[model samples]
Target: MTSTLASPDLRRRLEGIQLPDPLGFGTLMAPVMAIAHYRDGAWEDVRLDALDPLSLAPHTQALHYGQAIFEGMKAYRNLGTDLPGTALLFRPHEHARRFNRSATRLGMPELDEDVYVATLERLVSTLDALVPERQGQSLYLRPTMFGATAHLSVVPSTEYCFVVLATPSDAFFTAPISAWIERRFSRAGPGGTGNVKAAGNYAASFAAAAPLAKLGFQQLLWLDAVHHTHIEEFTAMNVFVRRGDTILTPPLSDTILAGITRDSLLRLAGSLGLSMVEKPVDVAELVDAIASGEDVEVFGCGTGAVVAPVELIGDETGLRLPLPPFPVATRLRRHMLDLQHGVLPAPAGWQRPVPTR
Candidate 1:
């Protein structure tokens, strides 16, 4: 087992910190973090150190030009076992692949896949004691990379820093979420950074999400930037709709993020004997279907909220579409959670056990 480079004080900090009564999503962070630096056209040593503030120059290229990218994943403590300090990671390699894709899209250097996986394993293993044991809780991992060099020119930085931070978190959304269909401010355009997990993509969403939050909506259901009639996805999740035996989700494009949980659900839908299709979902058509009782279920999928049912979707004109009982979404969420928590046997290569040092 590889040893972590965390200082003794860092270890003490981990042992002393107590999680909050309700571990809200991304609110409390673990004591240690993994960091790797890239300089002179090469990657450097990856270290596990105490979680501390980062010191960056004021004119950091990432701050100015937006060369930052990130990924969200989770590590779950195994279920039905009294084993001390053991956990499982679901589709970590898939996340690594997506991470590299995000890096490439932003003209940034990609972390080696082996290094990415090993760093994640080392971080999870080192913090095994902090991995939440509850059903809806897990160690949420955020892997972020940013251009570090300070410059005023509009160009990629020569140096970069990649870091992985962990937080013991509950479900991102505890209840069914209400979405405000965004028509005026589009999340991403046809040939933009919509496909990548770029930091700016989320920063742009604040414009639409702030007003919706004031109106009691939980999230922004983004529409296509081109026509504003097609459903792209939510601010942080992939959207899906169910009509009877068929499961429908928007087709993958350069404008929509390819979500790992979304892919897993689509594959699991086949096992559950539900037909799955990926096509352009028109907002008007979906609204009409819901009003006519043709579409019975709507949901969103992502790493944070494995599967979250959408209870209602409202537009700017005060017209709202309410979905019926979320039978399909609920079933899929249960099955996916079962597989994640080791209650059910995981499909081949889906779950990877975290090794304890």
Candidate 2:
């Protein structure tokens, strides 16, 4: 409800926007946005403005050097009532920490967590009426920071800009997803930007993932860049394998995005008496186990999809992994959504409730 970068035109622009009947994932824009400029060695008054094109130099560092980082999170509405616009932010501080970590790795100034959290709360508060209340629906918030100065050389930009945009979306997974075990491409190198939600890392996925999409694959399971044998992660989600009472996931490395949903699942799995193993996952061993009649259940975890069971895993020479029902993933998935919507007990300080009049 509080903003320093208030513009009447921006508010008018947001008031004029309309959304589709079924707002698919990241498809419909919420008319309003929050933006703050960083220049002269400090961040200035952040503002709530209309979603519009930004004015940047032709040689902006983000456009050229790819110095951009972003985070995707959702805000829920109506915790105790069947009303719209309740706005519950899931584990927001962890995201704030990760955001600063990414900025430091990219050689940019770190963002203030207090400032970031406050800014998000303010934005969501003002835009509370736009938050969707339907099941499997919420306001998807995208917080992005980029170097904005005109720079040609390989150094960091002096100036930067951080913006948060929202989209009211339905469920990300309408059907069971089919993933191709990508042997040709690796999402990131050993010491690369894989852990961080950097824009370049996502752009790198397009060339390899596009081909798989052409072959009717919903997602690409990227392998290790060097060996092309170790399982890294799906292009966007963290993967987990279940063999009876044991839950196995690839340990956090420099090559995988540390998903918040993945972390929450691991935490809940511990309490549910599931043995957790975090190490390098060999893809060949995985297929071998699946073929050997191991009770294999494969699912992907992330904020967007929450928990999407993998229907099939295809590879060259016609290799497909058809997995059975994974109880752990199912239990975790239910627990996650339940807690997010106030069905189950809220974990220690997990949900940040929006103000209700």
Candidate 3:
């Protein structure tokens, strides 16, 4: 788990920089990064270096073949606790496993769990003092892997690079989001790479999200690719709907990403005496349920925002549905936040404390 430290000048730069006020999500990056490379059929030693632009070749495989993947995670500074300046990472192992899964799906070399977790720990420990202490603020960690070899033969690259970048930021969505239902564009097909967190999946979604952004919507709700009738997921988060004492979400399929926060809330729902069900959620039926006074509450969940209540759902045809107040979502959000900040008890192995050196 050994890691090389950053240069003296880089360390001084990191210490001297001031974090700006109103820290927006993923806006302010820390001055250091963790990097590793895979070559000759093995991963090289990880290094802690200055945060700078990467020196990839103009003809790199990642640029041409689109074999890039990434993971989003957070490290929190436990507030109002006996251990001041203590940092806690949430579900590092789960993220590492997902990262390996992504790499395997893209034909890239996998990163060892020890190396993945060690890189995160080293970076968080080094920047513990810089981690925001506010309740909704945290150090957002982005671990990415991509094909690095330069070739245009439509083959997977032999060389790859893994890098972890840190950003001290606030919540991604501050208010309830309004999503535009995209009926024309498809996010992923039946046999596509939607289940994996590949970089291209997101790039393919921007064409649908851009127009919605101008229409005062925050995200695009994607429907199934084959039939275009069933609800799939939002661009970045998993979809959830609450009716009465039951919670419903689309079941995991080859075209949906299994979100970590979505899984946590489903488990918490059962503990709170709420029934959870996973099935195909038809978009038309959901609209009808809301119209028929079924008291449906819609929300989105992901690692970035944790939980976001959906206030409105609309499409280009001018059909819109306004959901009621989100009591269940608010309760679940508070409970999850409390558990993350060490105010309440978290399940065993959910939170890992960073080493203080």
lDDT tens digits by residue: candidate 1, 124-220? 9888878898887999999999999989889888999999999999988878999888989988887799998999999999877878767778988
Worst 10 residues of 1 by lDDT: 1-10
Q: Residue by residue across 1-357, what tens digits does model 2's lDDT show? A: 224644556555556456577888877777788998889898887888877899988999889999999988888765544333467888888888888888988988777887787777877776766677665677888999999999888899999999999888876775578888888767899898999999898888888876676677788888999989888888789998887777789999888888998898878776777787887888988999888878888888888888888878888768877777666666777778776765556678788776552
Candidate 2 global TM-score: 0.93
What's the TM-score of each model vs. the native? 0.96, 0.93, 0.97
lDDT of 1 at 292: 91
How well is each residue in 1-357 modelled by candidate 3, as lDDT tens digits? 346656666667667666778998767789889998888998888998888899988999999889999999999887636465689888899899989988898998888897789889988888776788887788999999999998887999999988999999887886899988899999999888999899999999988887876787898889999999999999999999888887899999889998889888877776788787998889999888887878898888898888899999899889788889999888877777777777766788887888886
Q: Candidate 1: lDDT over CA atoms?
A: 0.87
Q: How many residue pairs clash in each candidate?
A: 0, 4, 0
Identify the runs in model 2 with alpha carbons over 4 angstroms from their true place. 1-19, 81-85
Native-structure RMSD, model 3:
1.4
Q: How far is candidate 2 from the true structure (C-alpha RMSD, Å)?
A: 2.4
When summed lDDT is taken over every stretch of 10 residues in candidate 3, the lowest stretch is: 1-10
